[model samples]
Target chain A: MNITAKAHEDLILVTVGEDRIDAACAIQFKERMRELTQAPSSRVILDLSTVAFLDSSGLGAVVAVMKLLGPDRKLELSGLTPTVAKVFHLTRMDTVFTIHPSLPDGLQKAG
Target chain B: MELVFDSNLDAVRGGLADLLDSGPLCAMEADARGTAEIVLAEVFNNVVEHAYATRQGRIKVCLKNHPDGVLVTVIDSGSPFPQQQLPQGLLPEINAWDDLPEGGFGWYLIRSQVRHLSYQREGKHNRLTFCLPY
Candidate 1:
């Protein structure tokens, strides 16, 4: 789970640098996410543009990150590939997270 | 094709990826390969977490490819599911993030992606068979 985090204003944009997030990387993803998100701003935008595939474990990891962010902070998602978006839609997780079509869309809105 | 591996997270991921090779049934259509990949990942992880639990064992996976669809069979010798059956229907009623669900979406995603899914326990082995169209 090679994830990169950068802060922009009151938002922190985290990008996942992996083609797939499954059971193999779910733990690592969550652990790294917790570290990256320790110092939170008003919002955190998770960019999944590079993630071509996501499983339930991956979905859970995202949820965990969201909870770790607590209620005061917000977690948004962007750049979901078709396959990755399908997981969110099928699980109805799309309703839980504010999703954007692209990183720029989320970034602009967050700003 | 058959794959037998330790009931571990890493192995589960590798096993699901192995099923998505560039074969005929593994063709790319409506993101079917991606569907199978996600479905297999969820189902395989369930076996490792629930069936195998903390016990060390091997999960036997078989992939049967057909012109119309593909059948995936997963066999594990650990404890059978609590219900000894697949959850009826899929998706849970999740409309808000107020009480966001942290889990319980694995089976729903699996069922929604596949053409058919089934689970059964024969003696000491739990057999789960699911099929998806390409």
Candidate 2:
């Protein structure tokens, strides 16, 4: 799995490069996100533009990251492919996190 | 035949995709193909992670294409899971950020994606079967 993190003034944008994020990479993905968001940032935007598939474990990882960020920090999801978006909708996670159409949009909203 | 993967999830997915891409099973439509791939990846990930605990183990994937659809059976001698007894309901009220719960959504995904789902434990072996209509 390839994960790239770009830090902005108030937000960090992380792009997931893997086509699928399941049990195999869920732990790694969560740890990487945690490391990226450790410093105090206004928000975190997860760019899933390349992710084609996600399972329960992957969802759990994202949820865990949100909890780590807590109420003080905002977490947004952007560029969810059709399949990945379906999972979020099915689990009703679309209601939990702020979903944006793109990273720029998410950052703009957060800012 | 029993297949072994060295803790590589993509390799297992690729192997399954190759198997399903050939023979009579290749006739599956695009939607069915997508659902089948998702189901396969979910189950295979379960076997590799929960069952084997990321350790080395053997996964037996049996595929059969019938007139109705395609049947895929996964058998592993790893940790046993009581998937049959899981409660069935749509918890739309429960938000994702709420209190964490265990062993609910994975079964939901499996039930929702596959046409049929059944689990059996024959002694040490845990067998899970899913069918997809072509």
Candidate 3:
């Protein structure tokens, strides 16, 4: 899995360039998200445009990041592909976090 | 038997999809695409996670179109997951309104999807095989 981080304004955007963020990459993904959230950002947008699939491990990693962010910070999701989005929806996580259709939408909403 | 992936999850799915697309297994009455993908993801994720904990390891996956259904086997030298000790019972009722929990659902999905799932540690390698029947 390849993850690229870019800081924009008070938001840190982490774009994941992996097909699946399952158990294999969950720990690393969690670690990176943790580091990003610690830097004082109002919002963290997880760009999943390139991610095609996610399983329990991948979902756990996202949840872990959400927990680390606590209630003070905002963690939003964007660009969830149909398959990936289905997993979130099936787990009922769609209602738990703010999910946007695109990066700009997520950023605009966060702003 | 068809060889489609070289251990990577993306490649594994691609291989599985391609094989299913070209083989007789594709015509099966049951919808195993989603189930197969989920099961493969869980097993492959385990390889990418625990087996290659510090160093990178390679995994070999093979899908065989059987007379009854399909047999998928993942072979890796990484850490092994104990199939016998798997948690058994009904799926936990998920409250969609609340936050989602991480990790346990993979096991739940794997158990629910496949008919006979087994994991065996052979020497230093682990082989996880699951049979999905039509």
C-alpha DockQ of every model: 0.65, 0.32, 0.29
Q: Give TM-score values for chain A, per-prediction.
A: 0.92, 0.90, 0.88
Off by over 4 Å in 1: A105-111, B22-25, B95-98
Scored by CA lDDT, what does every candidate get? 0.81, 0.73, 0.70
Give the alpha carbon lDDT tens digit for every residue of A1-111 in model 3: 478777788888888878777655678889877765677788888889888778877887898788788777778898998767766776667877899898884354332
The residue-by-residue lDDT of candidate 2 on A6-95, one tens digit each, is 778778887887887776688898888888787788988888888887877788888888888887888899898876787788777787
Per-residue lDDT over B97-121 for candidate 1, one digit per residue giving the tens place of the 0 to 100 score? 5566767888777777777577888
Of candidates 2 and 1, the better by DockQ: 1
In candidate 3, list every pair of residues with a backbone clash. Answer: B51-B78, B51-B79
- Candidate 1 is graded, for docking, as medium
Worst 10 residues of 1 chain B by lDDT: B17-26
Candidate achieving higher lDDT, 1 or 3: 1
- The candidate maximizing lDDT is 1
Q: Write the per-residue lDDT of candidate 3 for residues B31-74, one digit (tens) a residue.
A: 45655666667666556656666666677767777665688777
